[model samples]
Target: MYYFNPDMLMMNGSKMSFEEKISVLREQLASADAVVIGAGSGLSTAAGYTYSGDRFRKYFADFEAKYGFKDMYSGGFYPYETMEEFWGYWCRYIWINRYAPVPSDLYGRLLELVKDKDYFVLTTNVDHCFQRSGFDKMRLFYTQGDYGLFQSCSPGGASKGRTYDNEEMIRKMVLSEGYRIGDHGELIVPESAEISMRVPSDLVPVCPDDGNLMTTNLRCDETFVEDEGWHQAAERYQDFLRRHKRLRVLYLELGVGMNTPVIIKFPFWKKTEQNPNAFYACVNLGEAGCSREIADRSVCIDQGIGEVIGALGV
Candidate 1:
């Protein structure tokens, strides 16, 4: 059974009771012509893909000892003295989060809930859980960079952004004499060597015309790539909005935080405000509140997402 701390509940005022919230959600689910799911870090948390604990220690014990980072998210932003260690941590992160099955059935349940509907997902999460859960790829948009994808720093350069083929990179890393394998099959690298290692000059992605180190397509920096796929996805999302402008659209937002309101929360608020027919639903553990303008049409379920999904039987 999943546990929830009462302190995490973020309902600000006496709104609808839990039954009312569930009733409204069921109503919205039944009537929505198109369901748009906006997801954030919380969704993955529900799926048991935490950034710390056994998983973190398994892949990042060395990084933690050397850099003092306690979690994967913090580690990602930590300023490691060298790119090698950074990439090493990131590669392992991508490998596990992207390739490994989630710890729970939460993602699968989410997919089941929306499978029968005309649904599209817009998520800031890079974990690719939706795809792994069997959601149609074409119907989902991962606004943030994906862990599995690598973009060239210069697409046309000789070493232009090539998706770091995981199998290839892992093969190379394992073959390189630099990595140390423990008896438990854990991989380790020397802290000094990590600092000296660059993301291989050759590996640095460049434009097809000019070789440059390829970078993760994440939007954290100016180097984030906006390739053809990005534009196409944006167009599809826009088209969805345009076509469903007058329909009973349901914007089901889950676990969106304030760190990047523009991506999920703000858009949900704006879109719901613009469409009288739209019903905005937010299911966040500790941050489940919405504007008064749409409050009558909103259902803020301040509870654990896993519990919510379980209740839905999705």
Candidate 2:
């Protein structure tokens, strides 16, 4: 099943045809003894979970009209004057990306590609798309914190370093439908209600150990929760790499961008270079290119993740 074709490899030279690229990629994936999937924000974006354009407009039209921002990323960093407004935007962001289902079966198609093979995922996406698509939970290590988990981010609350799944509480908040825009465009909520831009102070989630406000468990700080579950997943990823160090493994990187090249892109290149029996494949639209060092053993498909995954027809 080994299909390591040095001649078919293309570096920064004339690009390989998309069909040829898919063929080589299919062979590598089919023959690999183990597969390590490295995913990033782009992968989720490719799966129709983009944080901008129609998606953002649909979810945050009020915010956009008030703030003059066009996308969710800009809105996430917007200096909202109050925690209520912040949660107004953040909660919806989390709910749509985390709790709600994606528009496409990209993750399902991906699961079918590697379901029977020995595969593990190392992804920076927090959307929980992999698990939602039926991938085994034990085989995943979400390097970044999950959108569904929350922790206290206040200075004093840092010591109360407990993080827990906030899905239930968030569901309650969302289900309450406790918010609306006022005549002046100010976010309005019932004063006594526990969930809204201006709900009662007691209603919002806070640190159980202290009264610090709760925030998503994303990797923005040193205090981001690496709970017992996170550690177990990390150990499993390391073990998977160790067990297949020099075997016929494939490092399948998907839609990884430059935001964190060292995490996924650089490591995949290094691993492929170090292991002659290993093959490396990167699928990114427009941003697909391999370093000259491992170019011979790598396949760079400059096509959208969903398109290529669809082409595989698994």
Candidate 3:
């Protein structure tokens, strides 16, 4: 195992020894009161939930020819003419991300490292990896929607007013035993055998009380659902911040990118700048760096999360 040392600081263009980086991280961890983990797609990528390659081919090969999308993200936005095709792709996506085991043990290692710390996670990843890896569900805020949820579409009093019973959706999808046309010729079931289970364009998911179109609880469009659960999680996140504002908090950012700087980077920069007792650490394979203002309290380790977690074996 590599050990970090104080004199291990290297120039920007120069390579940073993993041992030295680990030592620095250990020191930061030792003094941290509350650890806030900010994650992105890169964290999932490290765990082997890659958007393309064998995983994508296995689930979406059929649609690739028709839509030319190589990954699930692009596939989500693909203009499928039928709901059957759309649901077919999404069901597979949800199954793989929500039910399947990721390629690496990175999430588990992360859980182990933060198990003893007063920690909270704010992640944009929709895969539910942190919970699967044994992190406390209450301590996590999945800022984005989950793969296992389905919502209703209705113009509510909010900018995006939609609601869903995620449990019901998961149960229905899993219990349908695979997508098949019902007696009324409605697609319901897994798309493994039948790729024709398209969600109807007119299909508005209704409240059990009122007939309305159902939608996913995803934060993609204006109709994204911001239900009570979302607000509660946001409150928990705020509470965590307020409780640790004056403590030595460690803002550990992993695999975050510029796609949503406001979510991860901007907040990290602001917090570290405001709190003298705070430190910011970022670990990204290729994209790793921090502003000079927080240079003394920041460490941008240009390494894969899995490798770093392994080096920090709990």
Candidate 4:
């Protein structure tokens, strides 16, 4: 049984009725001078971008049967027999997660809620949903690497690789075998039994910087690319905080997880604790709550983010 820690409830609204909590949150949204949205995979999950179960089966049933890896996350780490097989798995992974249209308009709704407000987004999620949802690109910082980006997998001067948008590269590799991307984000392999085998060596994407293999620009190690764009976004986030120090700022965290608590949750908590004008709210399904130190001004809702944000009726 999942315990609903009342202490985790934000804004001291543990005892408040559902509608009452929504009212309080709504009022805060309406009155705040600025909002800082912290997001994680759970936000995308709430937006119907799941990585496991049916979604995985739909895209990777053959891999599951062959490799016994059940979900997309597990498959990423699986040791495949050849680069041919590896790129086969990864291109589809990138196309679906990076290029597929979101099923739910949760991000779009959240954008509507804060479109007019002075806002900044700090997110651990790599899905590029903020830009897709029509949020101001200038105000958003994706702390994690994007799926649509590729970096040199080498270690050296070219090691600190610059990021490249790999949309065209991914499309080319996936189609090299005559596999068409399906309408619902799965791969449609050729009628000929061996679709992935025709994947040519030239189809293997390489780093222009170093002539080495290319890998997704995700944060897997110290080599994760932090090019100019990343630093610029980081600077902007810091500037936003400094500029909004005295305003009624709301640090609204949505679906953030424990994978890297310091990135979003811990920093937000510290900021809220230090700034009297800052208010913190965390809306995660079954994971909503704040530390006791910042409890008075926090609003932690133990509910699905889509449900909570939808209730805001933005």
Candidate 5:
């Protein structure tokens, strides 16, 4: 129901030097009554979880050779011939993105910046990076489904209405493909000849209830399951916003692009516009900006999130 009027957006912080914006953000963080972070793919990308380039080549070269897809994102959408092939690609995808050690301490640094404040994170990322990096789970809400969970795809399966953890199965799937687990839980590719693009038929995950295939818990379609946990997190987020409606709140948006503006971008704009005591800030490499209506109360820094966070000296 949210509408995005491009004409209302502006990179008004363009007038301020990067250093000035950083200073303002730091001061606001220290003084604001609460902070609500809206994170997207860019934040994880800043933390070295890129979907393409070296990371993609390192983990997905075999996939690229087998299929013509160049990046992880595209590979997700590829119509594989069988469930085995699909799960093979997805298991590897989940292992690297969800279980592997974070490449950088960006999330930890971000946690430090807000750990002392009353803050809640609203992220589109499914990597479980925030929890893995030690952010309070109670204060975090993963609006999109997780990479580490799977839900029954069958119409009437016993587990149809729930999500199940995929860690154990994903690890097994990756290990089956000759990828070894390092001391720190990183995936190590085995010899070239041992790599595989399909898991064994028996290794493909299935719903225990009716023996049907289980799909990722991601919100790709209406079939996406929002279990009890999801509902609770949504409730908590609503409560947080309600409590801070009239407070000196800071909407700290990080690396959120235009992919799903209604979830984070537009809501942040609308909330900031409603509260005179609220401040809105965005940290994105290329798409940093704010609604022109709230330009005076916003700061949109067009810089890498890591660089901006580093400059904050927090």
Candidate 6:
């Protein structure tokens, strides 16, 4: 049911400066009955979880040297010839993004802004940043799946309607690649020897129940599993929306982009339009905006999320 409609996109060329918009956002957050945070990859990027550049180079240098992909995102989709090689790239990818510590406290600062309020998170990001930073698990909906989980490749099995946690296996695979775990759980490249670009054949993950190949729990295709937890979270999100629909609600969007607007962007716009009491605020680096129909009730701050959240001083 989630579908993007380009015609629904709109922006206002407001005369209000960034300072004025920040002031308005602060006022709205304080007064709104509920806050529904719609997050995306950009928020993670803002929180120092960049998918490219030095961060990618630091962890994925072995894979980069072998595959020639400059960024982590590109490496994720590379068609490796063997499962050992595939898992070699992905285990590190999942570990650093999901299990390792983030470079900054941006998520914590964001939580400070809404810790006491009735807030629910709906994010496209697979990284476990929000929960890792102390956000309540029951109050979040990860629409794009998670990096810390794996799903069964078989259509019918005990793994049906289930997702397996990958942390233990990811660690095993990383260690198999000759990487060492740092004191703080970060992956450390061994100083004395080169890291392997492939995992041991036995390290490739398989479904426990059916012995089938396991895939990343990300939502790239129809095969993505929607387990009981995913369903419960979806229902909770709907309940939250119903309870706040006509009240003073703030659709606080952070770092969302146009890749899959229907999941968060379009719905936020639609809901804002439907409820006169609703206010929509977007804080993306460049894609911040709302429908012109609801322009008067919206604020689009095309600024970095970390800067805006920091300025809020919450």
Give all TM-scores, in the order shown: 0.82, 0.87, 0.84, 0.92, 0.94, 0.94
As a whole number from 0 to 100, the lDDT of residue 273 in candidate 5 is 93
Top-down lDDT ranking: 6, 5, 4, 2, 3, 1
Task: Give per-residue lDDT, candidate 3, residue 87.
Answer: 61
Per-residue lDDT tens digits of candidate 6, residues 1-314? 32222122233543677777788889999999999999998999988988888988888877778778899989999999999999989989998999888778999999999999999999999998999999999999999899999998764667788999988999999999898888878888877967888899988888987889999998888889998899999999999999988999999999999899989999998999999999988898867777777777888888899899978875
Is 1 or 2 the stronger prediction by TM-score?
A: 2
lDDT tens string, model 3, 179-253? Answer: 443453233434456543344433323555345545566788776776677789999999999999989999999
Q: Local distance difference test, per candidate? A: 0.73, 0.80, 0.74, 0.82, 0.87, 0.87
**What's the TM for model 6?**
0.94
Better of 3 and 4 by TM-score: 4
The global Cα lDDT (0 to 1) of model 5 is 0.87
- Candidate 1 Cα RMSD after full superposition onto the native fold (Å): 6.0
Off by over 4 Å in 6: 1-14
RMSD to native for every prediction? 6.0, 6.1, 6.0, 2.9, 3.0, 3.3
Best by TM-score: 6
Worst lDDT 10-window in candidate 5: 1-10
Predicted structure 4: lDDT: 0.82
**104: Cα error in model 6, Å:** 1.0
Q: What digit string (tens of lDDT, one per residue) describes model 2 on residues 168-283? A: 77665554556543453233456685543333344477777666778888887676877778899999999999999989999999988888888888888889889999998888
lDDT assessment of candidate 2: 0.80
Deviation from native of the Cα of residue 118 in model 3, angstroms: 0.5
Query: In candidate 3, residue 221 scores what lDDT?
Result: 76
Considering lDDT, which of the candidate structures 1 and 5 is the better prediction for this target? 5
Query: How does model 1 fare in lDDT?
Result: 0.73
